[model samples]
Target: MVRKKGVYGIAIVALICFLLIVFCTKEPDTVRISHNFQAIEFEDVDVIGEDISIDKIIDTQRLRLERKFDVFKFVTNKTFNKLSMLSGGQPLRTIIVTTWRSGSTFLGDVLNSLPGNYYHYEPLLHYGIMQIRGPPHADTAIKTLKNLLNCDYTDLENYLTFGMSHIYLFTHNKRLWTQCEAYPQYCWNATFLNEFCRLFPFQSMKVVRVRLRLIEELLSDKRLNTKVILLVRDPRGTLQSRRHRDWCPGEPDCDRPDLLCADMVSDYSAAIKFNKMYSRRFRTLRYEDLSLSPYKVVQDLFDWIGINVHPEIKEFLDTHTTVNVGGVSSTYRDSKNVPFHWKNDLNYTEIQSIEATCEEAMKLWGYVKTKGPKLRDFNPLTSYTIK
Candidate 1:
């Protein structure tokens, strides 16, 4: 009887090991590719070099494990949620907060590619440019933003009537304008507002010119239901790009790299504070990370924002994000190459100047300072593909 018991125990142990191996080696389930998926074909030689596999692009083991977990969780949760249709009344309101030259435009464009998206670009920019005391004013700006969230144009129209051309330039949507053209005053009226609100429930605003402190204050307001995407770039990269654009080349304070670095430190400090206060509602996106893996980064971002990664968006990234600067006949640069270009553009002194003030901020945001011109580790050249 004892000998039989030992044999049974050994068989059970062997069975458990066999089951573990089977489960561990099994391939993860793949989501069916929707017919709506679009592929963007590009002829640019610079953008079309040896294709990097998506697996190679996402080399971080931690990130890969998280993504794997997310896939299982996402599938299960999504299947459960599909039992009932989600309502448009409670659409996700997103605020993309960033500083100048932080690639907010690129990120915004990707988010805006989603259907039924109402995008307002830099609504507070006019306030800064016009020296208007209201738009950036916490209460006033918050009120205007609330109206936008509710899809109301009454207050926005009144504000624009003050000859705020800059406001019009940024906030105006050509498609909406065309749709409202037949309406009185070209659909800048109540009926048009109602229809616009009904048609496009999801709203997004990308703000770059606003102060981070004011944004924090606005978000702190419980009445405003919005998620903030704090988009950040390495100070070295942002400053180098700004220098290329001559955005503050002539201004003495702006020309001083140290001052800019200090400002970046302040900005990132505010970001860290805001994130701490609103961890769930506030998500941060780094330009460097996004550049290295656009599809993966975007997938994770969309998942975090309670949305599914749509196929059209993937196509949009391929088509719009990868392109040459000007006289765009064929030549184009891959979007992945956008990050770390500062390495080539900025000199040692410039990088060091940025590092002096932004060291803590850089570390806080997962930016590692290089000992030399380039990072010895973390090579982006890897084979990967996202289907």
Candidate 2:
């Protein structure tokens, strides 16, 4: 009996000590998710849970922004915005500025390969054949772009609908397309599109219509937090690829290498200027270099745009760059050999015309000018580096 009592007393003391120690030790007040650039964040929280915090953040952010945000206004009327990156409310916005047939579709897909992005394919498609040319159209261009970037589809209601020249636009956005396919009722409903767009942390668009000078104002507005990738291609290769398009011949804006080179000259000057001004935000990528080294170029591109190369982006690079060329508008290509494939399509006479017209760009952008040689099959007659 005495031994039993001693053992019980010892056990009780140990239990009490453990309880006191646990009570005295401080527990952390809050925890953080490892990554900060996630869908949403919390300013006040006792516990950190993604689902709970994200919903509260969304409601708070929407209410705060709704006060200053005008439904149908733009850069000319209302200034861009003040939301921080994905960390706060706004998603990162990037525009790929390139001419048609310059592997822009492929490059756009590279950005789209990031897990969650609201991909805008050729937003200027609504502008039709006569792209944004001058003052008459400039305001409209800026306004439209601002609205789209901000996920405000108020004015674009007509263009944002289904079946009438908007199929391609929705279909290109895999996530949106999937949801739309699943729920046809919400396919292009302005409300659905707006909400869907907000869910993403990145917005990517490719525009062949606007010039660098035109977008200077858009980039100036820090609130938009816009970045640009000027994707330039050798006119020789550009014109060759453009030949595949039946409509390009008659459109001066489309096929004429001379006209294209002139635009490039104007844009290239602006590129140099923008490089000095917005070194972190603006990038110039040559199609040849991208094709020659897709992995390295894309990795660098991701870093420049404030992201690491995502696994999906890596898989896209692997599968898309190495596969044989697909449909005319398809992103898949044997990227390594696509640069010089134009040589097989164009004869020396055609090459001379393209080269002569693009001489200044070729020289400035570093393309070795071929005088009278007929080395059509020789891998890219023009060097891919800048002089």
Candidate 3:
């Protein structure tokens, strides 16, 4: 009888240990559910919470869950949102349009670092695809656009129900803009443009920051808020950089008569003509200003758009300084030498041609000219004297 009793006691002890092990191994179901739901929310809208038949109670719970998730997402990704908050609900609609190698990538990286701003690097690709392909169907397009804009269709419809009144920054690669009209079949697809305009009837603002003769041709679209920034460098420096570092495939050959060096006389003639035509709306900032004191110029630009500078902006500027081909440094190693190294690579004739072509732009932007003739009334690009 004693032996049997001892054996029963041992059996009880073993059963308790097994139960404890099982409980420890199992993860909390609630935590698992929450994580899965969040992942689903980010990927697609249809993967939300389980549906409850009762309308009122289910709707309230779903709203609560969404709000909770939104708060979580914001906390996790506060950099962009911080900028949006600084704007007091009027988020920046910035478009960093530029010709190849004009330091737009650098500018974009800086803007992207700011909180609350949605920075799309080369968004023109998406725009082109949509325009050419049209939406898969009306429903799919509506859903995608709403997601892209981060707003509901109802909100967008209400905003554009009236006439065009809002400010939209439409930044594009200069190459894309140049090709849109001339090589219509190559880059022009009206489906996206037509739909976007029809859906959102707001004035489209463009950023033209390169020294190109094509600027005048761009003005045919009267509705464009064409702001030009004739970003220029010393002719010697420009050509050298173009030859060694910044050569883009499929660009016009610099040797061709029609395709003069970007800094040549023809380029300046085009810039001057464009500037005169859109004098009131045009603005220019030098490549030097961008390299040296980017924050000040960018701040002024933000102010122009009525966005008050955040006090924390100084902190961001102090920390981020390196400029690379990809724009911002993904790593913290210092890289200030990248921008100034183009001076060592150009030949004399190349330098002279660049200077000859870009003389007008150089004078306009207050660059000290080396070989080109000076303009009589060459106003500094930043000489926007407010009367």
Best by lDDT: 2
- Write down the lDDT that model 3 would get: 0.39
Q: Could you tell me the lDDT of residue 308 within candidate 2?
A: 52
Model 3 C-alpha lDDT per residue in residues 26-131, reported as the tens digit of each score: 9755311121210111111222233322233223333443443354342233333232222222223443334434555556545443333333343222222112
- Locate the minimum summed-lDDT window of 10 residues in model 1: 40-49
Write down the TM-score of every candidate: 0.64, 0.75, 0.48
Error of 3 at 137 (Å): 25
Clash pairs, model 2 backbone: none
Per-model CA lDDT versus the true structure: 0.58, 0.71, 0.39
At residue 104, what lDDT does model 2 achieve?
90
Q: Give the lowest summed-lDDT range of ten residues in model 2.
A: 36-45
User: Comparing 1 and 2 by TM-score, which wins?
Assistant: 2
Model 1 pairs in collision = 52-384, 53-383, 53-384, 53-385, 54-384, 54-385
lDDT (10s digit) by residue, model 1, range 109-228: 677666445677666554543212224366777566667666667667544553234434433343343333222243345444544443443567877655566676557767555789
